[model samples]
Target: MTVTFSLPPALEARTPAEPRDGVRLMVSRGTSVSHHRFTELPHLLDPGDLLVVNNSGTLPAALQTLDGVLVHVSTSQPDGSWLVELRDTDIARTGLRLRVPEGSLTLLRPFTSRLWVAAADVPGDRVSYLTRHGRAIRYSYTDRDWPIETYQNVYATVPGSAEMPSAGRPLTGAVLAALAGQGVLVAPITLHTGVASAEVDEPPYPEWFRIPPSTAGLISHVRASGGRVIAVGTTVVRALETGTGEGWTDLVISPDHPIRVVDGLLTGLHEPRASHLMMLTAVAGEDALRESYTEALREHYLWHEFGDVHLLLR
Candidate 1:
């Protein structure tokens, strides 16, 4: 699958969309498409439809080294080592120690081409340490730094994701109330997302996810009752389609590996050649996805975490 358009820098959403209650939403069902405000999302769904959203919180995972290089903390390994990305450089040497604000990190070895295993320490818990010294991760598309609060969703509670589960960013309390009033079921699953390799467009690594039996039961009931199980982000899709209650997931959804659980998706616009486009293809079909992207680009829809969203229903 090839995406033929280039993303203009001006189309990048440099800041959070104002007033989270509404934003541009492109709804695609088959090869058909329509534009609507995100607040109209409830109207687009049937009474029994279920919207599965990821409640994993964003961590202020971007930290600066003593020399001012940025580090993206990806995950805490079970053995007390941390998996991190040295964002300022393309290569890392093992046994190199870099001094951080609170402490220092000693690179143990390579975890991936862009990530390394390291030992990290601070005054207290990792979260607390980050709260004091870290900032939200951003790329060149953003013009300036924004508060960490802007990187969070209204309902986020679990603190783990290196970046925000941004598809849920525009959902507000008002929207949730409206969905409930319209009899649309909303369920939460916790999926701790690791740092994204946006530069490389690499396949995602395993991340922790938890779908309680209650949400699992809701999925089963919705499917049996002729309702669509709509995932709010690729994170939720990965968690639900893995068909597990709680664990780390390395599942990669593509056209060849059919998606069994999700019937629809609400997600941000993915970049051309992103691994995420493969997952979107699984739910929306290749032609529909291609059409949607072409329309989005033509319509000047914003891209990235703070951008507008796309809804794909099967």
Candidate 2:
């Protein structure tokens, strides 16, 4: 289906001055919408409700050289190889070598357009190798070496993701305590998010994810007990959906593959034609998503990683 929604220049104000839960939260279920502080999340759900989170830790996927050009690496091949994409360069050499603190980086010419397949020789597993040789793959817009801690989810673990599962960012220590105090159940699953496709660009890359049987069992137990399964972000949705084998989901989310596991989804506003919007279409239907997105735009909701959050329930 062709998609359309409102885009407002004013919405940029919603960019989290602080990239945590600075996002405005909108909760929707049964034709109702309630705007509330993200901290108030626990109050909106019942005790024993299951909150499934993606524990895929973010990597310092961005690296720089003395020349000032930047590189963004996303997913890795299961065979311990990397499928990388490059940004901010017109130098299309057949092979490019990037110098890092501990090793030399090499790129195999354009996989497509501006993307290049790159890899580095390090001392251990890919994650460990990256830890020693790379910086968290960051966007030029950010312009800083945000410590690895800044890119990790509170409960993140495992190591294949290029970035944090951002929708869960608001569930801080205090919020976790609040959820615990309220008897809400929090379970973590791993789904490493590859490099985020730009709002204005749609790029293709391989999928990198790992979902444990125990996590699957936990989700099943929650649903079997009549507790709602709340997915924290699109990454979590992708992880849960991909792991469940509803079908081979190699691309974006869509209604053709309606979600079979998650009872609700908490995500951020996306831009026109953004691939993640396909996931929202799967969760809320193209019509409802357009309606909610229209409301978000008109309400001046922010966009991007540090923006407003959307909560939709089935």
Candidate 3:
């Protein structure tokens, strides 16, 4: 099914919400839809529900060449090479190696096709190099560059994601405390997200993820007790549904697939025709997703990483 809509620039959020938890949330359950402040999420969920969050921390993935060209570090290969995208340079074909500034050399490869394999000559480690020189990846929708902290969720731990698992960004300490006080369970998994510029029809690339034994146990217990497992982001959904273990996953959740682990989703408001929309449709049903997106647009809800959220329940 083709789902398309025009996203006005005015509705794109340019900065993080003032209180983080001050963002708006649109909830969809079956045919019903409601709106509330993000802080009210604890009240919306039942006491026995389990909230699974992605704890993969965002990385400063943008690097600049001495010649003033920008390169985006998209993903890390298992062999220690990096998948990188050049901002403005053009390459005619694959199998070509180009020398970048700052002593880095990039080889055009077929992995992901759009990104080249990059290796830096001067680096203690990829993390160390990125920490010293890279900046957070931003798009034209963002008015200006913001600090990496602005993109991180309150529960971030394992530093790996190329981009923020943004659905959990509005979950502040106060909100988490409130949920815990009400007896809601929270679990953490890790899914290091790659760059987010996939073509509309392109499938997702493999990304590293780990579902800890503790988290896996909690999910099993929650399921046995009839508690809903609410995934805080698409990354968490991908990790849990794919299985409880550490590995690279290229699992794509779309309308053709049935989700087995995630009972609900709390995610950022995605634009129409986005790949994420396909995942949303799989969870919320196509008709419900359409209604929810229509309502979000009509209410002028924000979109993107620093935007409003949607809670879709079964």
Candidate 4:
């Protein structure tokens, strides 16, 4: 199905909501749609429901090469290397080596011709090297530079993701406490997201993920007790659906696929024709998904990482 809509430039949120939970939330239960503040999430859920969140923290993945060109570190390879996306120019080829003050970088292979697998000649761990030199990756849509903390969720713990699991951004401490007071269980799984691609309909690349035995057991128990397993983000859904204890996932959720684990999804308003729209369709069904988007657009809901949220319940 071809889903398209006009996302006005004014609707792109330049910064996060001041109270965080002040963001608008569009709730879609089957074909029914309702509006509420993100703070009302607890009231919308049943007592026995389980909310699964991604605890993987954001990483400062953007760094400059010797020539001052920007390179975004997308994913960390099993080896010490990293999958990187070179911006502006296209000189990043197989076996191309770049010299930097921190270390030398050797391009291994092209991840997508624009992105390449490259290794840095650092003495210490790659994470440490990046921590010392890198800055958080930002798109042109984001008006100004913000700290990495701005990209983090309230429950973020593990450090791995190149970008924030932004769907959970509106979940403040008060919201979490409210959900807990309502007897809703919360759990965490890790999925280190890579740099988001602008290429439409492209499948997600393989990324490291870990679903602990405790979280898995909780999911099974929730299912057995007839509780809805609400995924906080697409990253959480990807991790829980494909991960055991630890592994890499290339699972692509589409309309053709059946969602076996997640019963609901809390996500941001994705762009029209974006790959994420297909995943939303898998959870809410196409008609509901379309209606929700139309409502969001009509109501002038913000879009992107720092925008409003949509909760799709089945």
Candidate 5:
């Protein structure tokens, strides 16, 4: 089925900061659209609604020129060396010139004008490296450090993501409290986002992921109890759907793929043609997804990680 989608200009990050949970939630069911706040998620669903959250923690994956040049490493090998995607090209490759304080450098390699590889010894764990050398990945619209914690949901645990599962970002301690107050059940699963790829093409590379059995059982229970399984982000939907067979995914979801689970989705507004939109199509179907997105564009819901949300209920 063909789905038409677009974003509203008003939703653009014309303003840098949006209050946590202050973004709008555009709820779509059939041809209808109901504007709501992200904080109102609990009240919008039934008591038995099962909320599935992605606990994949985010890394301050964007690096800058401290000594030389800044390259954002999206994926890392188990060996600690990383294949980072770089942005600037003014620096020489002979010596990695980054703005990072002295004694922070380890190894460096340039892959292309726009990408490179850099390594650091780092103290403690990988998280330390991120804290010391990296900043959160930002696109042209956003221009600030959103705090590693702001990029995360209250329930995030597993840490390996280059980006946050933003749809879940709207769910703060207050939102969770409200959900609990309303008797909604919340469960978590992990799916480390590798990198945010360009919408112009397919995914750039394979993303590694893992899901625990306890979360799987919670999903099964949610399904069996007639509680609508609501995925907090496209990452959660992808993790649950892809990992159900073996708790992992090397597969990409698209309209052609058949979905095995997830009845509802709470996700951010995506850029036009983003691979994520394809996954959303798989969940909401062509016609409805198209209508909802088209409406979002007309209504001016924001886009990107810090943007507003789109909740599609089937």
Candidate 6:
């Protein structure tokens, strides 16, 4: 989908999506479009459709250097270094030492245009260190700082994500109960999200993910029984497509890649140039994606992590 449009400031969801069920859900199947309240999600899916959710908790991973530059610790590398992004600053270079309240991180090399490999000298576990000294990462689209709880989904358990797996943000306890009563199934995947891409030119960094054996079996069973496998977020889509139990996934689900798992996606609206758009295209096709975004913009649907959601079903 090559369509693009201006994002007026009024349409950016600047705060938390509280009363998550109250948010709008735009459902798109092929070129057909419909709108409903997010609480109605249970009725949208058929019986036995499996909804795979990401349970990786959001981390307050944004810390400040001694010079006040923001460092977003994204993911930990296998070699014990961390992948991190330095926001709104240009002093980063190889061998650079970023000092924080807890410890210092020495930059090793460029992982991406905005991210660098850094060795952490913080005390205790990385999660605890970040918990004690860091705060939630926010982009310029947001109006003000919000608490970490606001970024987290109701079902998040494993703590690792630098940012929230926001597609599951609208899943309220009420909706979960309704889905269960409706005979829809739910499963879990752990994909710790890294920081989002701020530039269109940059691709996403590799993320750590784990797909439990039970969840994998459920996906196959549900599909064989004529049920759809619906991914709650792009994180779940990425994790499930890796075809492995646990590992770092570098898979970028563009139209070039085959959609091996998810038959539908429940996700938040993305920015104009966001790479997640490509993944949506892979699922819904280019024409459907093009038409859906055009309609979403015309209807004044909000965008961003705290915004309204888009359900792309095949």
Q: Whose TM-score is greatest here?
A: 6
Off by more than 4 A, model 6: none
Residue 4's lDDT in candidate 5: 47
lDDT of 5 at 70: 60
lDDT of 6: 0.90
Q: How many backbone clashes does candidate 6 have?
A: 0
Q: Give the alpha carbon lDDT tens digit for every residue of 1-314 in model 1.
A: 66556888888888778897567999999999999889999899999999999998899999988877789988777677888899766557899888998789889998888889998866766677778888998887888888999989998998888889999999999999999999999999999989996788788888889998999998999999999999999999999988777977889888988889999999999887899999998898889998999899889999999899999999
lDDT of each: 0.89, 0.70, 0.85, 0.87, 0.73, 0.90
Error of 3 at 30 (Å): 1.4
Q: Write the per-residue lDDT of candidate 2 for residues 78-126, one digit (tens) a residue.
A: 4555666656556647577766556555786566566666666645666
Better of 5 and 6 by lDDT: 6
Q: What TM-score fits each model?
A: 0.97, 0.86, 0.95, 0.96, 0.84, 0.98
- Global lDDT of model 4: 0.87
- Per-residue C-alpha lDDT of model 4 across residues 1-314, encoded as one tens digit per residue: 56678888889998878789999999999889999999999999999999999998888888887877788888878876888888764676778777655787888887764678888786666567677888888888888989988999989998888888999999999999999999999999999999885544466889999998999999999999999999999998888777578988989988888889999999998976888888888888989988888898899999989999999999
Q: Lowest-scoring 10 consecutive residues by lDDT in candidate 2?
A: 244-253
Candidate 3 per-residue C-alpha lDDT over 219-255 given as tens digits, one digit per residue, 9 for 90 to 100: 9999999999999999998898899789999899998
Candidate 6 collision pairs: none
lDDT of 3 at 300: 95
Ranking by lDDT, best first? 6, 1, 4, 3, 5, 2
In candidate 2, stretches whose alpha carbon ends up further than 4 angstroms from where it belongs are 13-22, 123-125, 140-145, 244-251
Model 2 / residue 206 / CA error / Å? 3.1
Q: Please provide, for model 6 over 10-83, each residue's C-alpha lDDT reduced to its tens digit, 9 standing for 90 to 100.
A: 99998887798789999999999999999999999999999999999999999988868888989888888888
lDDT for model 5 comes to 0.73
Q: What residue runs in model 3 are displaced by over 4 Å at the alpha carbon?
A: 89-102, 198-201
Residue pairs with colliding backbones in model 3 are none
| Over 4 Å off, model 4 | 199-201
Q: How far out, in Å, is residue 230 in model 5?
A: 1.0
